[model samples]
Target: MTGWTAEDMPSLTDRTVVVTGANSGLGLEGSEAFARKGATVVMACRSVERGESAAAEIRGAVPDATLDVRECDLGDLANVEAFADGLHEDYDAVDVLCNNAGVMAIPRSETADGFETQFGVNHLGHFALTGHLLDLLRAADGESRIVTQSSGAHEMGEIDFDDLQHERSYGKWDAYGQSKLANLLFAYELQRRLGNHGWDNVISVTCHPGYADTDLQFKGPREMGSTLRTAFMGIANAVFAQSAEQGALPMLYAATADDVIGGEYVGPGGLFDMRGAPEFQQSNEASRDEATAERLWAVSTDLTGVEYDFESA
Candidate 1:
């Protein structure tokens, strides 16, 4: 997979792809790339209006692109369930599900379900969404892929089981790191469970966009009303980060590449994994701990109340 780009993606005609946070940044770029390859993309955005605008923008460029815009607010489990219900009503099977939506180092806040915002939306939300749709994914004619977006911040993470929600104390970056780490744990655990259930046609993979220049960096600072932090992040993005399209390559590769198997992590292969072409990479050891993954999975299922029906496949 040396120097792999979106142009290297195989045809996705007749495939269905679901991309969360599809309105902007890596999600937008990935959605456009999938659409260009003839995949029927389901833009799962928090805002239906913005999702429609993004769909319109893609249609302007790729006239034949088939797109559907749907509302999926990850912070709210009810909204995620509704979104999945709508998809189940419409499509018999989904070929790819990109767990791309996430919040960065934002101020400590609670989601609608009273969980920490970053962990709630980033990891738990995707976990619940995947469970809700796992059956449909298995119904696909061929192998169906679930590509989840993680981050390099995961290296600094340690799952605080005593306080998974960070209710006792909250450090913004630490919370973000924990959530990102949960992403890897969830992805690896899901892959293992699918294998144990003999569902080889379904696979789960994780990826990270190394220092991608996207609005995600600014949102946290903007939310905290810290102009100085926002400006610093902007300068850093300008100097060190790659474009969103370039950063999205790893996710696209994980989702569509023929050689990609379950449980693999994809990321940029440059200095410190900050930028470059997509390649197979390794996550931190904590992310690979089977015991941790299994415990996290149990906690997630209990928290979200969405259980995977492995036998349904």
Candidate 2:
């Protein structure tokens, strides 16, 4: 994917896709790109109003776009379950699932479900949702793909087994890093298990938008436009990031490329994978550790109470 372009992407004519956090940024742009390829897109977000607005934006761009807006608050597992159930009822099967919605570098806060906000929303919620849709994915009969959005921050993260929640102590950056790392691990392990279970028909992969200028890094009111915050964001955006449309390229490639393999990762092809053309990328050494992958999967099942037959995941 070193020099991949959307024009080179195969048509997604019959694909039905769902993208989390589709109200804006990379997710929104990704949905737009997919719709342009003739796929039916679903924008899964926390706000129906915001999602519908984004849908309107996409439809304005692609007059014949087929799109749907569904409310999904990832911080709450109850909502995830409902979202999955709603999806199952609304569509016979889904072709692609982009686990892209995420909270980044946020201060300590608890989700409605009482889990740490970043970990819950970015990792566990996706974990549960993936499990919830595993059967439908397999039923798609080799036409399905799952893309988990990760980040370069994963390189700095180590899964703290003693405290997955950072219950006793919490730092915003580290928690966010840990969550992103878990995303990679989850994708890798899912691919491996699917292979072991003889379900090679399903594909699982991970990707990250090289430093994209998105609202992912700013959420709270106080940090919205502070001078220092603005300066830092500007520096990062100018020096290392691409536009959100560019940021979503690796994921778009992973989702639509004909040759993308399960368990592989894709990212920007540039300095530190921060910006440039889309291409295959690698995560930190910890991301591929088989032992850690196994334990993390078990821990995820325990925490989310969403168990899949290990032989069929």
Candidate 3:
């Protein structure tokens, strides 16, 4: 895997893949790659109209692409449940789930559930979604994968159990980091739980797009009405970041590479992991703390009211 690219991905004909935040950036790139490899991609976005437009663009490129556009607003638990329910009604099994949608460094805000926007949508939303779909993923005919998108920002994160929602105080970057770190914690802990429950057919993996040029970098500035900051970020993206398609290599690799094992983290392989091919990487120590993961899992279940039915395994 020294120089792996999406072209190296194995054929996924007959497979069903779900991608959240598939309207643009890495999500759209990954969805297109999966479609090119003969997989049926379910584009899960917050807006059905935008999703359909993205699907149209994909079909314009990959004429025979099998695609579905569905509404999945991670900021709302009810919306996520409806999305998962629709999937369950339509498909018996899902070959892959890419927890790729997220918000970053925006002005302080709360989700529909009253949880911090970053923590709620980035971590808890995906957490509940995974729980809702675990059974269908396990029912897949072959090995199935759940790829959670994390970030390098996680290194600076510390899970503040006392202020998980940043209720008392809020720092946009801090909240974003915590949520990304939670992604890693959840991914690793899910793999462990799957192992203990004897569910060998499903594996959980984590990946990060190392400093890719995506709309995410500009959203915060735009939201804050800071044209200067937005322009600065645009300059940074142009000068330092890799293309979204190139940045999506790691998650695609984690989802499709035969050698990828459960509980592994994948990211860019270049200097400082900012660009290049996909490769295995290691996260900070806090991200792997089992005790923290367990507590977070319990709190997440309590908050989202979604429980993993591991007993069935």
lDDT agreement with native, every candidate: 0.96, 0.87, 0.96
- lDDT by residue (tens digit), candidate 3, 1-313: 8878889999999999999999999999999999999999999999999889999999999999999999999999999999999999999999999999999999999999999999999999999999999989999999999999999999999999999999888999999999999999999999999999999999999999999999999999999999999999999999999999999999999999999999999999897999999899999999999999999999999999999999873
Regions more than 4 Å wrong, model 3: none
Q: Candidate 2: lDDT over CA atoms?
A: 0.87
Model 3: lDDT to the true structure: 0.96
List, residue by residue over 160-263, the lDDT tens digit for candidate 2. 98988999989888998899999999999999888878887788999999789887755632444466775677677777667898898999999988888999
Give the runs in model 2 whose Cα sits over 4 Å from its true position: 220-227, 310-313
Clashes (backbone N, CA, C under 3 Å), per candidate, total 0, 0, 0
RMSD of each: 0.7, 1.8, 0.7
Q: What tens digits encode model 1's per-residue C-alpha lDDT throughout 227-284?
A: 9999999999999999999999999999999999999999999989999999999999
